[model samples]
Target: MIGVLVTFTQTDKFDRSTLAKIAGELRGPFEGMAGLRFKSFMLDEDGVQARNFYMWDDDEKGRSFFTEELVDKVTGIYGVPPKIEYLDIVGFVDNSGT
Candidate 1:
């Protein structure tokens, strides 16, 4: 598995409510997305940052999803470019079925 962390540090231009609205609008595309195991949108209002965490079943698929064009599009939406990091998922626990 692969973990992708996308951080946006332009919270000065967008408040928590705005970020929440953006997340709500964008959440649908990720639902049932191929190769995606899980996704979360996060907010750090006090620290002035917004972040998205994605877990993908395949590293290639996760890495390929974040293209330059996608970065540019997200930059336009958040009013700043994001810092994206890809990580190896050593282990995880899921109890949603329970």
Candidate 2:
């Protein structure tokens, strides 16, 4: 498994309602994507940044997803270029159902 983190710096702060709407709008694009295990969208408390954390079955797929075109699309939506980082998944702990 691999973990891909893409962070976007914000040009302005968004209110809670606006942020929820943005997250809703962005969710459709990621549905049923190939090689994607799952994704979590996040925002900082100060609302100065947004991030997408993607878990991938393959590292190459994760790397390929962050193309120039994707960057352009994210910039178009958020008004800032994204910084992408890929990392190996050393371990995972999931106990949500417990």
Best by TM-score: 1
The TM-score, computed over Cα atoms with residue i paired to residue i, of candidate 1 is 0.93
- What are the runs in model 2 whose C-alpha is more than 4 Å off? 96-98
lDDT of 1 at 41: 88
- CA lDDT scores, all candidates in order: 0.91, 0.85
List where candidate 1 sits over 4 angstroms from the true fold: 11-13, 45-47
For model 2, residues 1-98, the per-residue Cα lDDT tens digits are 99988898866885667667888988997899999988998888888888889999898988888888988997887778889888999998878769
Candidate 1 total steric clashes: 0
RMSD of 2: 1.7
Clashes within 3 Å, all models in order: 0, 0
Model 1 over residues 10-65: C-alpha lDDT tens digits?
A: 63555878888998999999999999999998987475888899999999999999
